[model samples]
Target chain A: MSDDKLERTERALDFSGIQAPEELLRMKRATPARIGIGHVGARYKTAAALRFGADHAAANDAAFSEVPEDIPARLGFFSVQTLCRDKAEMITRPDLGRYFDEEQKARILSSCRYAPDVQIYCGDGLCAPSIAANIPDLYPAIRDELVFRGISVGTPFFVRYCRVNTARVIGPLLNAEVVCVLIGERPGLLTSESMSAYIAYRPHPDMQENAYTVVSNISRFGTPPVEAAAYIASLIGEILEKKKSGLSLKQNEE
Target chain B: MKDVLMSAGIDIGTTTTQVIFSRLTIAEKGGFGAAPGYAVTRRDVFYRGRVHFTPLLPDDSIDKEEVARILSEEFESAGLRPDDMDTGAVIITGETLKRANAKEVAESIAALSGRFVVTTAGPHLESVLAGKGSGAAELSTRTGKLVANVDIGGGTSNLCFFDDGAVLDTACLDLGGRGIRIENHKIAQIFPGTKRILEAESIRLSVGDSADLPSVRERIENLADVMARLLAEALLLLPESPTLRKVVTNRLITCDRIPEIVTLSGGVADLLGNLPEDPFRYGDIGAFLGASIARNGAIRERLNRNTKETLRATVIGAGNESLTLSGGTVFYQEIAFPLRDLPVVTLPMDGANPEAYGEAIGRAWERIREDGETTAAFASEGLSAPTYEEICRLADAAAKAARQKDPSGSQTWVFVFATDMGKAFGQAFRRRMPPKTSILAMDSVRCGDEDRIDCGDPIGRGDVIPVVVKTLLFDNGERETI
Candidate 1:
């Protein structure tokens, strides 16, 4: 990121003596891939190889970084952690990442509003940096839209070292009509700030994966965070009206 | 869910008339409910009618009844009724659009053929269509090269430049094949433009001139060579000749740069396929003109050896390439199908400044009212992934400005947005509009100044509007830069 000129140059096909320079430049505008790097003696150029290495390191940092508890507290949401202690266990022991003790459960019910029309929260699923990058704009877009529609939403919070399955426990425990989880997606070469939203209607302990409706690949570079928020808002309205989500919702659409 | 729509293209040109029907597949992307952003994913031309000479009465007016009969017969042969078609275009091109009854005749014919739309008639639009139909656009898109095509029809030669499949600039000239007609080797009829050119060249041959005079034949060949040189100059293959300005019709081409490939189309190009021995075989100067153009080294050097189409480029373009789909989530409560020729007014968006945005909307509304339009499409290049507050602010400003002008909400309001924020803005505008107001908001569509929007019936799995942005006539006085 430090070399601004190199960042723009590597993404474009700027090889010398191109017959159709304008057309090749147009193709460059359409994609984010590393292209147009002319090789010397059948090997990668030094700058291009270095840029690839730099991008790989950034993805790793996004995966291993932790979102501080103070960040969620500033947004007026209480935070809790799962059974996993660190990033190693969160990645290796995904089964442990889905659990919470009785003491933490007591703290959740006490701090959260009960039986609201909809409940939404965030989790550091795989990329913690994505949470701070998108939530400030994303959260209000969804909340204000639902408010305008005269739909009620419950208390929001954060869960550390979380998995997608955690929404199942929160759904039945709070007795909410619908539950939505905004979490970070696994980092890819193109972007480390992408996030996802998983939603369901009336969750239970034994619910399957197909029970949740999901929208993913959300970031400033992918689907705009605010645009994704607007879509999630309307989706919540449809789920409440139809009383369904995931496979059932798709079937009903047919 | 996948839906297929049947479409027909009817071209009423200066020298010939034709009809073509195509099946357009509308695939629901993302999912069925997600088809608000929809397009014709695939197009297959199922029926192509044989070319027929355009029938003209003694008074030089198009024979309306004969035209109608040709259309009916073509549809019957294709096993399709007019009602079977979901969307299509009827384009009256070249000199035919200048006839007194052109608009009325075109409208009636369009109505006779399903929910068809007629273009107002513009050379730029025609140039783009011909470029597309002739495969020049596709060639540039596929090979990543700059391509240009000259559609040499009966009364006009349209030059369009394509860079990576998008139109860059267009120009038209009063050059064509049917300038002089022949019968039994004798001159039968001469159009006014050809008469003027002949008089300037000092060639005294008139109608009913001797069929086998060597002097007259030599003069005609000289005229053909002169025209071929002009065509070469138009593509910058040669130096700009002295007569270049006099032959240009509406506007001059501003491509400025040389294209990698150039293609020829229309009837003259069709005639060049095998270099007919008889110059007057088709009762016109087309064959002789084609031969002369083929001999011109400047054009031959850059010509595309593979011509995808010759005589049917514009007609195929009209039929298959005219339909565009509206995208993003949309909101339209009670709009009727096939809304044709809604004049567009583009409102200026002052980026995050609500007060400036409101003033801009108010001024644009006044312009629409001044133009005496009962309904118009308001277009904007919308913000990227707009936040909720930004959407609300803009929507609120627009609603308030509109309320002051048309308090009773008698005029229908249609917002043509440029991004997927259509439904979001639609919902916000819906909440604040007057109770009697009806609105339509659609996005992922682009339109230019002076263009008209024609929205066909909602089709397929999603509420996707088959939209047509028709630019019939335009004067690019100050040419646009890339």
Candidate 2:
């Protein structure tokens, strides 16, 4: 026998690498190494919402309580929320949260009156932590900007998966020229707290993407949310003046 | 009084369907409220023809009836009956329509809805994205040439060119994450136990699992490389001058979303780890050989200035998409909503969060939906639902074929050859087995149809056939050969 054959014969049959059962190899080739995009991690889109806080946790109760009349939580445009934190349970489980839960809906319906020129809202997008952290600081700036422009702002309402399409729903709801939505951006590895604005002209369910503008990377460490809010308000200004949102208006400007 | 509304937007996408409820709101006096200067618009509900996010099958068919049923259910669930919607916009993707039944399925959905569904197909996803909104106008202003926006999705990549914010050309390629998973069939096998658990949790249906992990991963990587080249080649076909900037994706897909600021939305450019300090400074002479594209002087300057704070490009692009409009018509008024083709870049999973993955997937899918017309070469017709048992059977048959063809163990012996060749052989061997059977590389293998069979032993000079066949087998499993 040739030296190669002798060596080959002496070598033990390496069976350790057999991953699947021997029966599965009959018509099989080598295992394919498909290196493409992977769903390495996933949060179920249809699961029940988890509530982390205690006492205030709405998950613990299925009923609504009346708000004290004396309390100054009275309806104001600034009091609007684009997303109710309780609605966040609808993130992965949209079915559970797609529609407003009863009490929460009542809270919004009673507190928010309709027919402003533009309804500005902030939602607990993909990152609740960021929404909670930034809204307190950013709301005032945005409100002031809209008020300064003489843009009639209405009580804000939030939605789940508050996409640009959400603006379309808001358009008819507010009977406004536009809807400016400040919601949590889908969080990335770079940062979790970033927020984006979706501003649609003649907002409606059919609103196009260009009708919305985004100002993202809203971490306090980056562009302060307050500053970002100011810039967004200005963009809304341009949208109103030009009556256009995307490349078309930009070109006419140039 | 019950209100009636009718409108549909068919997002014939690479992975899933996004049906928008066009018009269904009560212009109620106190509903949106008093002294209301705002418009109250509502769509009672929209229907989604949620299909399996896979590539088209050889048979070129889809479950039309099932899709229609699901859509009808959605409409009913939304408190609207099928007859309520009078006008609809059926958005067709070029890739999903390729295998033949795309029109049939789309028509079926339209027929069921009982509305005026105008079915249209653009070459790339960017058209859909542009239609949604993106600064197609400004880019055209800067560069006199019509601008093309490419969107990379989970199951396809869509490219679109706009002149003064109007679409000129489009295309789509089925080279997305879902497509990769289906073709490679690795994820299904590697974590069978995990998959069962996940399915039990109702995360994803167990229709396409049953392949090996390594083989699937190998096929996925090879396809990724091929997809990048195909994308570059597609861009070369366009007449627009190459923008000097070369954008880099997360896994170093250099040409994913570079070249222009399609919109001023900040997040679109922020997530890709930041643009190169002088992106326009360097050019791959060999790569952009035919296209005489000069880099945007202003954009290059902007990148240099804000290199420190340009992540979340997709989010900002999504924002920009929201801020723009195409075709001069108000969004709600137009029957066919224009799709925006935002430049999208994707990064590999370097231990990123699920939200990031979802975002990447969402962005890529957006591109596929927007620019499906232009990237026709890369489109898949539709993801036909297949059972796990069928996939397993296919993988088993492929493995058996490999074993029979190279029975001497001589073919298997090649596993001990030089490192690269040996690795390739081993990879091929694995792909021949299990869930790896699902992937189909465009030009990977030569089968019995060509009368090309491997010789009993290795030839001294190395025949190209074996290597190619080996690669083909590795990329796809045994049963996947044409």
lDDT for every model?
Answer: 0.80, 0.38
Q: Write the per-residue lDDT of candidate 1 for residues A1-254, one digit (tens) a residue.
A: 11232355555334676776666556666666677666668977777677777777878988999997689988778898888889899999999788887877777888888998889989989999888888887887788778777888888889999888888888888888999999999997767888888999998888888978888877766566766776788889999999999889878866
Question: Each model's interface RMSD (Å)?
Answer: 3.9, 25.5
Per-residue lDDT for A128 in model 1? 92
Error of 2 at B24 (Å): 9.9
Q: What DockQ score does model 1 reach against the true complex?
A: 0.35
Best by lDDT: 1
Query: How close to the true structure is residue B144 of candidate 1, measured as C-alpha lDDT?
Result: 77
Q: What are the models' TM-scores?
A: 0.92, 0.27
Q: Candidate 2: lDDT over CA atoms?
A: 0.38
**Candidate 1 ranges beyond 4 A from true positions:** A1-27, A40-43, B28-39, B199-203, B273-275, B408-410, B434-436, B476-482
Alpha-carbon shift of residue A32 in model 1 (angstroms): 2.6
Highest DockQ model number: 1
Off by over 4 Å in 2: A1-254, B1-6, B24-60, B120-148, B153-155, B168-171, B183-219, B229-259, B262-482
lDDT tens digits, residues B1-482, model 1? 44888888888888999899999888766642222345677888889998999888889888898999999999999999998888888888887876767776787797786588877457788888889888999998888778889999888889999888899888888778987888998999887667666666566768998546888887777888778888888887788865766777788777687877889999999666435666777888888788888888888888885878779899888888888888746666567666878877787665478777778778877777797767788888888767667887988898888888878876677888886677767767767877657788888888866678899877654456889888754475432110
Cα displacement (Å) at residue A19, model 2: 64
Candidate 1, after superposition: displacement of residue B445 in Å?
1.7
Best by TM-score: 1
